[model samples]
Target: MKYIIGLAGIVLVFLLAFVASSDRKRIRYRPLIVMIVLQAILAFVLLNTGVGSFLIGGFASTFEHLLSYAAEGVNFVFGGLANVNEAPFFLNVLLPIVFISALIGILQYIKVLPFIIKYIGLVLSKVNGMGKLESFNAVASAILGQSEVFISVKKQLGAMPRHRLYTLCASAMSTVSMSIVGAYMELIKPEYVVTALVLNLFGGFIIASIINPYEVDPKEDILEIQEEEKQSFFEMLGEYIMDGFKVATTVAAMLIGFVALIAMINGIFSGIFGISFQDLLGYIFAPFAFLMGIPWGDAVQAGSIMATKMVSNEFVAMTTLTNATGLSARAIGIVSVFLVSFANFSSIGIIAGAVKGLHSKQGNEVARFGLKLLYGATLVSVLSATIAGLFM
Candidate 1:
């Protein structure tokens, strides 16, 4: 019965995703839509059913090749640093983020992402019915992060209509940068880098479209096809090193701030309530953990990690997962990756203000849609977790 309900929900979300169309301030999304239903079923099957166990095993088995690939990277860079059987945390976590960021950056130079943007933007153009510039920003922001991805379409940003600008800004705030993709893999599971990347791509596409879906009319002639020189392999490699520096620093900073904030919050809770803040958060998100297929015995302990992700960044959530001493294996995999995001409550203002930049005159609309985008992004990640839980 749980499986039945869960599977049914996935179907529902897919339906809603299709109907999530817009035209001039009127969202035509059919309630109980496909995307929402798909997400719901995914949560059920992954979290509530025994299916998660099987999926977890499958995820390992299927991604076995990744272990080999990862090993190759370790051997090339830091031989003896990685055990073939046990992927060392540093190699698995840090290197992937750095390498992938560079790889994506080089791809950006070659215009691969732009090509993808144009293709996706064309489809989104129909759903959003917005200017090419706005649609382009949406596609670019999803694959890349806020400031970096905007470089790809910087010209569009300055000239885009206010409503379209808001959409693009909302999308940037709603997603993570490519720079941190590898670290998430290291934290969740060495193999999940690919999965998280794919999921991030999907999450961005979905949320951007949802934000102010009916705000604009289409304009293609205004959109241009910009071209650029491909970087030589050495040049691209150099670019990665530069990008790696920036990403690593940003990640380090986030880790420091969030880690400190968690410590501060924990101190307060312990001082005032005479209980651990983690324990409180655990209970707060326990039902959600249960929904993600964690065994009832360890759900709240796991849910606290989810709470941390919602309040902080996914890195902090993964850090908590790694540091957590008594959690069951059942709680480990599903919760780690599922809780990964820039989905914290603090993101509400960050994303809104970012998008508000696009709308010089419509900061109010940007503010309203920013909240919706954050919720949508969080919901989609929950959907990611619930679905991934089944596979766990």
Candidate 2:
């Protein structure tokens, strides 16, 4: 029964992607079929197998240790703000990003990260039937982040055509930055976070191939990563440390604003319509939730949380998911997988602005296709979650 629903969910996702395809005739099925099979196998291994459990456990434990180390720094700076048992979200969750970001900088400085991103991307390009640059951007986006990933490829920013640029941005929105992975694990199950990260990587390509099909001319598929200006080790370390803090504070600010606004809107809707705004959104998104193998009884609540991620951001939705009651564990797992990407409305502007800062004309091109970009990215999340639902 679960298999039937999961297969139907896959069909529904593909059909939706097919309907929006810019060039349905040009869509390649061979690579898509290969990737879909890969997604399922990977999902099964990650969710059900012993080796998968060991890997996820190690990954989660490593992040846990990293967060503990980060907490020492937080304690030194703001020791008395909260008791050990009652740490604030900003301190407990957001500040650890600073440490992880610094670690990424160290890896970047030593060139290890670039080496890994490059070779893995080369291997993925062979399977995904895309250009080296697109595959690199997808991998780099997962590690470096959406905005920072563009800086790595800034040399080709101006030269990329609209279709290729859409693919680039789609990958950025489909995957989460590694810096925030620990933060997400804190809000949901660590295993689900790991599963979503792997699934979304391939899912990004699968949906992009369908919705924005095009051939990459090998001659034009050159990948020239923009090298960062050389800085002394301490100089680089300080810079990353500050960058991490800025990200932490920025997320904290968004949480404050988005959470309050949602509360206000929910209040107004409840006052007038006897239904909270999220409940209204739940009704609209419930079918997608149901189609993703969430049981019909749980779909409405699951859909509301999914809608929250799309409209506000994943943090807000994850927080809601944590507080939500009456959802079965399976429903929670499926929804947790669904909320792991940067597929919200705000990301369109972020990706566009990131490109615009690099090259004005190319940024404008990103903005023009911004909605389509989000559409493809959201489908990527749905496809990944549906694939995950099969094994769960």
Candidate 3:
């Protein structure tokens, strides 16, 4: 029965994207259908089978273990203040990005990560029938993160057309950074995070192909990414370490403001209207939640989390999910998958600013389509969640 509903959800999501497609005649249903089937198969294997367990679960455990090493660094500096159970949220959750970012730098310096990204993306381009640049950007976004991914392709940013640029940003907005994957595992099930990462890769392409359909001219299909400026090993390591610290602190600041503001808004709503703000948003989003295979009884609560993710950010929504009660395990799994991306209000500005800093004109172009970018990425998250529902 759940599988039936899950199948219906996939159809509904595709229908929604099709309804908004720029050119129905130009829509490549073959790739769309292929990816949808692939999403379902991947979700099923990762969530249900032993192979999935060894892949997703093993990765999560290994990642969590890696994060423990970060804790040692945290303990070194802050002593008892870094113990997660006793430490503040930023201390335990956000600070570890510094270590992870350093590791990313080391991998890049050794040229190991680029080879993997290049090959995987080349393979995906064949399946998605998109340009190599698009495929590479999607995979790079997953690995390097949203803003950082743009730097990987900065040389081409000024030259690429708007439609291709949108696809790149959409991929960035749909996938979470590896640096924060551990923080996500701290909030939701690690397997769901891992699966969402995989599913969103295709989901971003599926939606972008429909909404921003444009053929990449053979002349513009170049995949020449600009390498970062040369630096000594320690010099590069120092830069990434500081960059990671900036990320951690920025996130901490945003959480402070957004979380507090949400509390205040909820207080006002409850005081005057006898309901919290999220509850009201939930009511608005409940039908969609139901269509995603959430039980009707839990739909409102799940919808609230969904609304929170769109209005604010995934971390805020995941925090809410952590404290939520009475939701079915299936609901938890589906919603966890849903909240695993950067498909929120704040990400639009983040992506735009990153581009603007590199190329002001191109950045302005990104801002012009910012809302639409969020729309496509949100659909990417919906597609992933719906497929996850099938396996759950």
**Against the hidden reference, what TM-scores do the models get?**
0.69, 0.99, 0.97
Q: Could you give the candidate ranking by TM-score, starting with the highest?
A: 2, 3, 1
Candidate 3: what lDDT? 0.91
Write down the worst ten-residue block by lDDT for model 1. Answer: 31-40
Instruction: Give the per-residue Cα lDDT of candidate 1 at 94.
Output: 57
What clash count goes with each model?
Answer: 30, 0, 0
- Candidate 1: tens digits of C-alpha lDDT, residues 228-261: 4466887877877677756666666777888898
Residues 288-380 of candidate 2 have per-residue lDDT tens digits of: 899898999999999999999999999999999999999999999999999999999999999999999999999999999999999989999
Candidate 1 residue-wise lDDT at 184: 60
TM-score of structure candidate 2:
0.99
Candidate 2 runs further than 4 Å off? none
Whole-model Cα lDDT per candidate?
Answer: 0.60, 0.94, 0.91
| Residue-by-residue lDDT tens digits, candidate 3, 91-188 | 78888999999999899999988998999999999999899999999998998999999999999999888889999999999998888898888888
What TM value does model 1 have?
Answer: 0.69
How well does model 2 score by local distance difference test?
0.94
